[model samples]
Target: MNFKQLGLSDDLIKILNKSGIADPTPIQKQSIPQIIDGKDVIAEAATGTGKTLAFLLPLLENINPKSNEIQALILTPTRELAIQITNEANKLKEFNDISILPVYGGKDIASQLKKLNNNIHLIIATPGRLLDHLERKTIDLSKLKTFILDEADQMLLMGFKNEVESIISKMPRKKQILCFSATIDSSVKKLAYRYMKNPIEVFIKQNDIALDAIEQDIVETTDRKKRDALCKVLDEDNPFMAIIFCRTKRRVDELEAVLHTRKYNCEKLHSDIPQNKRERIMKSFRNAEIQYLIATDVAARGLDINGITHIYNYDIPESVESYIHRIGRTGRAGESGYTCMFIDPKNIKDVNEIEDVIGFKIRRRNVEI
Candidate 1:
């Protein structure tokens, strides 16, 4: 369906067309009308399914353009997601004059404070920094018409439950609440039950073709031969750009050093790296300045890059959901991609769980020693 059929304003539809987004994704098509009608909504969709525009379009349509107060608040799980959403918002409002600000850690608070003092119509923030603003009394949300919890599960996983609840408490009770996530776990459901006013629930079934587009394979390797196995795959596949997922920050650092010694153009991303450096690395990766990005899950979360030819699982993620999230980096926008996993004997059980979740068994390939 198109944006106009979803009841979006002509200006916003024109903006979307200019951005080359003529048709709405399933989530956007289903949830946009509900949101524009001022109904509270809880939407479940996977990563890279265009959830950002699903909520942002309606938000732009619903807000009073003339009101100077902060009318909408969007809380994201990480600084990258916050900035990404803010950028999308800016693009949609290019022809319009609605003011939007993205507030997150790793930036100067004074600058954010100055922006807040100005007439801001929408604020996208990380939970912790938003709380800091609240504590300093530097921003006001009394007139907030809509509150959004983007990536609700990730926020709770990062131990921001209390901070999120506290921030929500500061918003007006009459405002609409929208919770969007890849999965509706217990914590997210609890939050909805406690706070939302009989929200309409929308669940977009996972696109089977997108999952099928990813050619997944596993290589059994001993702990000592894992690096050799990784090199063998890279030698054969020669991906345009690939992201290697390590289970820990230390592993990422170690792998990056080894790759550099082997003369591979690569960079590492994890919580230990400074936020500014992380952003630079992400930018470089997106521009294909770097051929490989070695990262931990936290650093890779909410990354919305395209043309990823392959995803390497150097370490099997701890959860089935995490494995799905890791592989989802590729095969986006109906493009075919590959996922190659290096599994040691110890983590074989994790692979089993992943297979169960995906409802198919991954083909095993012999690692060239």
Candidate 2:
């Protein structure tokens, strides 16, 4: 359905139209009107399904621009997602003139403090970083009308429950709560039960049949032969953009160096790098300046890059969830993509778990190097 039919104002509908978004996504179709009515919602959608804009639009539309207090609080799992959400919010507020701020770790607190003094209306923040500001009384949440948890699963994975609980305790009880996630487990359900009040649960089952447009396969090799097999696949496929997932920071560093020596424009991402450098690397990768981004699970979560033609799992993930999250990066926007896992002999059990979770057999493609 068109966005205008979903109860969005002419200003936001005009912005969306100019931004090339004529139709509302499934989640937006269901949640926008409910959010406009000031109700709690729990939306389940995959990456690249425009969940950010779905919630951001409603939040912006509901904001009382005259109030200087924080009207909406969007809690994201990572710094990248926080920044991205804040940027989307900024786009919709061209006519409203809302002051949106993104707060996360690895940035200057003094600067955040300076921005907070300017009548902040919306804050897209990571839990720990937002908690820091709350502790220092740097942010005022008394006028909060809405609270959103973006990527709820990842926040729990990052062990931010205490921070989330603490922040919620300080908020006004009458606020609307919205939770969005790619995949929800029992723990996430429990979080919804405790925090949200009778939220309308909306699920977009994209991943079940989502990647019919993409090709998925596995590359089988022993530990000694895995590197050679991956090299052979790269030579054969020659994808325009690929992200190689390594299991550890050291492994990512080593693999990035190896790819660099092989004359590939590759970048490394882990917890070790400075925030500014990480931002630069991601910016370059998104702009196609870098061909590959070798990263650990922590570093790769909540990324919103499109047009990734391939994802090479240099090391199989230990859990099924990680496997899903890793591969969900590619094959987006109805584009065909490929995911090849360099599976070691001992990692077959982990592969099986991934297949079991995905509820299908992952095709194994033999590489003759």
Candidate 3:
């Protein structure tokens, strides 16, 4: 279904059309109606499923542009996501005329304070920085109309349970709440039920998490020779754009260093990288200025840019969910893509688990190093 059928404003629709986004995604189709009708919604959608627009459309459409007080507050797990959401919001800002601000650490607080004084309608912020504003009374939430928890599972995983609960407590008792998560476990459900009233649940299951458009292969190699195997694959298939998934920040760093010596345009992303630098790197990667982005799972959330044609598992993931999550980055929006996993001998069971979930065996691509 198109966004117009979903009852979006002409201004929003026009903006989306110019950007070649005419249809509403599965998550958008289910959640938009309930959200626009002013219902609290709990949506089970993955990062690549357009979960951001599911909330953004209704949130922006419902916002009274004339109101000066904060109407909507979106809490994210990391500053990068807050910035990403703000970027998405800004794309439609010209039609909406709504002032959107992102509040996070590492950014100049004084600049944020200056923007906070303006007629801001939406505040996309992280929990810790938002809590700091709450405690200092620098931000007001008493008149909040809509509260959104983006990446609910990620927030709680990052140990923001108490902080999230405290932030919710400070909001008005009668406000619309929206929760979007990759996997809605009990904790996310508990948080939603505690604050929302008879919320509608939009569970959009991705039956084909294996992603048919993305070609998959297993590169049999030892841990010590995995880098050589990866280089062989890179030289053989020069991808348009790719995300190289590593298990840890150290792996990402080491991989970046290795690629740099090989003269590959690459960057590393992890929590330790300053938020500003991470945002810059993300911008560069999205613009295709960087050929490869080596990042851990946590840092790679919300990085759903188009044109990502390949995903490389430099480090094999331990779970089916993570395996799908990594590959899902590519083959997005119905585009053909490719993925290769560097599987050491000991990690065969991990491959088996993923194969069991996807109901097929991944083709093996051998590279003798």
Candidate 4:
């Protein structure tokens, strides 16, 4: 069904229509009406299922613009996620002068403190920074009517359970709680039950959308020779655009430095980088100005850039789903793409698990550098 039929406000509908977003995804279709009606919800959704807008569009529709209090608060696990959600909220601000702020580290505190006085109606924030604001009494959540935990599973995985609980305690207990996560483990369920009031659960399971148009390969290399293997693949493939996924921020930084020394057009993206620089790097990558982008899994969530021809898994993720997300960055809009994963000895089990899900043994290639 269309977003208009999902019970969104007319203004939001017009905005979405103008942006060429006519139909709603399964998560959006299920979650939007409930969220708009102020019901608690727990949505089991993946990153690419348009989950961001599922909560965002309804939240915006239900926001009371006349109230100065921070009517809605969205807590995220990482700085990049906070910024990404806020960027999305900003795009819908044309309706009734809605004020939304992104509260995260690496930005000026004084500037944010000043903006806090404007009475931001909605805040997309990381748990730590939002807690900082709470402790300093610079922002008040007492009037918050809706609390959304985006990527709830990631927050728990990042060890932000205490911070998330503390933030939730500060908000009104009767407020609507919406939790969206890729996986609904026991931890996420506990969090939902503790704060939410009999939340309505919605699950959206998307098949392997990337497997059709993408060629997958496994490159066998030791950890020491992984860099050389990556270089050899880049030289041979010479992709128009590529994203190299690392498991952590340190790995991204280290890989970017190595690729730079080897005279490759590359940049590193992680939560530690300044917000402005990250935006610039993403812009450059989207414009095809950068040949490769090295990023962590958290940093690359919600990234939807077309023309990505190749994906490189420099450090294999432990889970099968992360493997899918990393490679799914390519092969968009019916465009053919390629993914090369560099696996060391210890990563054999991880690759085996991933192969089992994909239902085929990926073609193995030897890298001699």
User: What are the lDDT scores of the predictions, listed in order?
Assistant: 0.88, 0.84, 0.90, 0.87
RMSD from true fold, candidate 1 = 1.5
Report the number of clashing residue pairs per model. 0, 0, 0, 0
RMSD of each: 1.5, 2.0, 1.3, 2.2
**1-369: candidate 2 lDDT, tens digit per residue:** 777777889999898889877887787888899999888899888776778888988888889888778899999888877877776777889997689899999999999999888988889899888989999999978778899988998789889888888989889978899999977778888987787888998888755535666677898888787777878898899888888999999998877777789887789998789888998998899899888889998888778787799988999886876676778788876777789898877888888877776768989898898
Tens digit of per-residue lDDT, candidate 1, span 1-369 = 777789988888888888777888888988999999999999988777788889999999888878898999999988888878887899888767799999999999999998887889999999989999999989888889999999998889899999998998888889999999988998899988799998999998764327788999999998799998998898888899999999899999889999999998899988778889988888899899998999888888878788898999998887877777788889987788899999989988888888887889999988767
Cα lDDT, model 3, residue 86:
92
User: After superposition, which runs of candidate 4 have C-alpha atoms over 4 Å from their true positions?
Assistant: 206-210, 271-279, 365-369
Candidate 4 weakest lDDT stretch, 10 residues? 204-213
lDDT tens per residue, model 3, 1-369: 788888898989999999888888899999998999999999997778889999999999999999888999999999889988999999987885799989999988889888888998999999989889889888999999999999999999999999999999999999999999998999999988988899999998767343888899999889989898999999898998899999998989998999999999899999999877888899999899998999999999877888899999999986888888788888887788899999988999889989998879999997866
- lDDT per residue for candidate 4 within 1-369, as digits (tens), equals 877788987888888889877788788999999999899999987666678999999899888888888999999887767867887888887978678999988788999999998968999999888899999999999998999998898889889999988888888867999999888889999988988887899987647354778899999989998998999999999999999999888899898999999999999998788878997898888889999999988888767677899999999876987887778778875678899999889888888888898889999987779
Backbone clashes in model 4, listed as residue pairs? none
Q: 3 or 4: which has the higher lDDT?
A: 3
Clashing pairs in 1: none
Residue 251 alpha-carbon offset, candidate 4, angstroms: 3.5
Q: Name the regions of candidate 2 deviating beyond 4 angstroms.
A: 206-209, 349-361
True lDDT of residue 171, candidate 1: 88
Per-residue lDDT value at 197 in model 3: 96
Worst 10 residues of 3 by lDDT: 204-213
The pairs that clash in candidate 3 are none
